[model samples]
Target: MTRDKHDFKKVVPFAFLIFTIAEFIPVLAYFFPSSLPRNVLTYSQKRKLIEKRDSIRIQIHTHINNSAKTNKGSDNAPLISQRDFINSTNARLVSKKYASSFDLSKTADFKTAKLMCKFFGLSSIGTFSMLKSRLAAHATFLRTDDSLLFKDLDSTVAGLSTVQLIEACDSRGIPTTNFSFPHLKNSLVGWVQFSNSFSTIEPGFYLWSRIFLLSKIPTTN
Candidate 1:
């Protein structure tokens, strides 16, 4: 009986220990679950992502600037000749289409000229010249009737061909004019051309620039 009691005593402590461990297991599991996914990205992966974003931004900005410059003259060499303006507008239309494929709207320094070209699909030399002639006519109407000419002429002149524009002015009895090779003077005739061009298109920054350019011309009025 004594030996049996001693064995029971030894077994009781072991049983208690086992029971305690079993009770503690549920609490441990509740406090700490399996490992979670890491939130950290590798340095190489982060650098690559940043590089890609910057490259995309640069391409967008270049496309916008190129479209504007091609359509309108550079700041130093403002487009004075109608031929150059027509050529530039046509070139800019093509470039704007190319750039727009990659989202021109999102770029910095984006010009209204590019957006106008894109919207109208005014991509050909012939189309641009025709458009110029039409605008010149409107300028004539405005001048003769004393009507509210479409607001801007500079933008209009930026898109016309010299031959058509000169002829239009001559037909209207506007004085024959000559623009210096690189620094062409903005003239009333040029503004007329610009106003006419803008009247045919939806108004926007490009249109505004054309008007703004024409408005800068010295008027005898």
Candidate 2:
């Protein structure tokens, strides 16, 4: 009876801690959006996470800084420039069925194929002749900017799914410590979407860094 009672005693504290973190904290956060509880990590763990975060943010900065090397306009550069890609008529003009059925190799499928060329660092996506080159360059990302971040990321932030956003924010060293999930997610998502509209790379980097800073509410204060 004593052993069972002792085990029960041991379990109760752990259960309470879990309840505090998993339930109580979120409840507190929902009510107090700006203020967040902080620093659930040990001092050493916090230091380590901070180091990792700083290292990755530096890498992101370096990647953004060095992105200007790949000049966009070559003689054979795609008629569909990267900035104009979303609105490009190349997609509307060329249909997959048409391209397959007819020898439309001469057509610049800018929104689709040609944009792929631009993204992959190819100087030309102007012809079907470069299909092999495009495929070969497929592994590369020429822009070296935040747009590449969005390539695999879903822009739909309304799903209320916080897992991937948390991972992304955490990896970016956004101090996943104490903010309400919804506000943090909203800040990051809204910043990304707003930054995405700019024709240049700087805005996206700037906006993302802003969110990262905002997510850095002190764990204690």
Candidate 3:
């Protein structure tokens, strides 16, 4: 009975901590409404999900182009030529199906996808579909200077997912942090965001980093 009481004492605070964090989410979400995805439809709703995802992509790109043109002359500004933008967008869509399949959970599937990506790179496929998608997403992103743009873009291009992102970054010689895309995506999705994202953060520090971020309550003075 003494041990049981002691265990209860230990568990109660942790349980309460989880409860507190859960309660805090809505309040945080309310203040940062734009940070949240517009909706959380189950993956089983394939048609509705595909429609929503497509609509969001169109909206984001349109916003990026409009914002880019307004800032055209700056040296560091988004100056992607109209022709490049059109070509990139088309190329990105071509690989969208493949990009969506680059999940790491199924090791065989991931290896096959990686080979296919490499094949596209070695072959005469125009724009190097996967890289082209990354560039298109990156360019659309360059046009906007929103503080939240990076995170929003992360969610938008999540179809590229995490393992692919790592490979993409490595192939292009981009610097990366220990942070994982799967960590961020799963936390954002409140469960998981497919195989790659889930596996990327599984039982790791990245997962804890997400929990820490979510646990904080924004203060107003």
Candidate 4:
């Protein structure tokens, strides 16, 4: 009876080990959605998204006009406005973790924030909205090599004046090439979409990365 009891105890542990391994397999698979092919949206779906984007642009124009009218009364407005514009642009280009730390909203004027919000299609719910849209449309992960495409496009828009950027955005349709503002705009959307796809795959990994970034600071003795 003692020997039989020992054998049963050993067998129970081995069974538990196998069960644990079996449970982990699906979890491991779910963490690498980036390995999957791109999911294409239907034409009607794409049209709806485009229309939504245009409406946001119109809102941005109205905000910009309102901000300009308000700031016109201040004497130091132009210099402050230009500085705020550049700072806001840089803030959006950087990671949200860092952008929030910089307090870009506090530093940027309403006009500048509206302009960036227009350019980047941003709101408080921006990232969450992108994730939800991707999930709803069954969008696929972006290609790893897509970063190279945006680098040149970003450089082209980076060289433009603030006025030029606003004008370009007003006149431009969807970007087809790296030479135009639309190209840069499309790249920004690509970035957010790709980031959302990645965050969805391994939310813990994304949370850790953001937390790790936030934890770093200068320590003084």
Give lDDT per model, in order. Answer: 0.34, 0.38, 0.32, 0.34
lDDT tens per residue, model 4, 1-221: 01112124345544564577756533433442111111222343433444555565546544544554564434644311212222223223333434443333233344443344333332323454343332222212222222333345456556755334432332222222223445545434443333333323232222212222221211111
Candidate 1 residue spans exceeding 4 A from truth: 1-149, 177-185, 189-221
Q: lDDT per residue, candidate 1, 167-208, as tens digits?
A: 333222233323332223245444444434433322232332
Q: What alpha-carbon RMSD in Å does predicted model 2 have with respect to the real structure?
A: 18.5
TM-score of 2: 0.28
Cα RMSD of all models vs. native, in order, equals: 30.5, 18.5, 21.4, 18.8
Question: How many clashes would you count in candidate 4?
Answer: 0
Give the CA lDDT, 0 to 100, for residue 203 in model 4: 25
Better of 2 and 4 by lDDT: 2
Residue by residue across 5-106, what tens digits does model 2's lDDT show?
212434555456576676674444344321232223344443444444445455543443344234335764433222222221322232232334222234
Off by more than 4 A, model 4: 1-40, 73-102, 105-147, 150-221
Model 3 TM-score, 2 decimals: 0.21
Model 3 residue pairs with clashes: 182-197
Best by TM-score: 4
- TM-scores for all predictions: 0.20, 0.28, 0.21, 0.28
Score residue 98 of candidate 2 by CA lDDT. Answer: 32
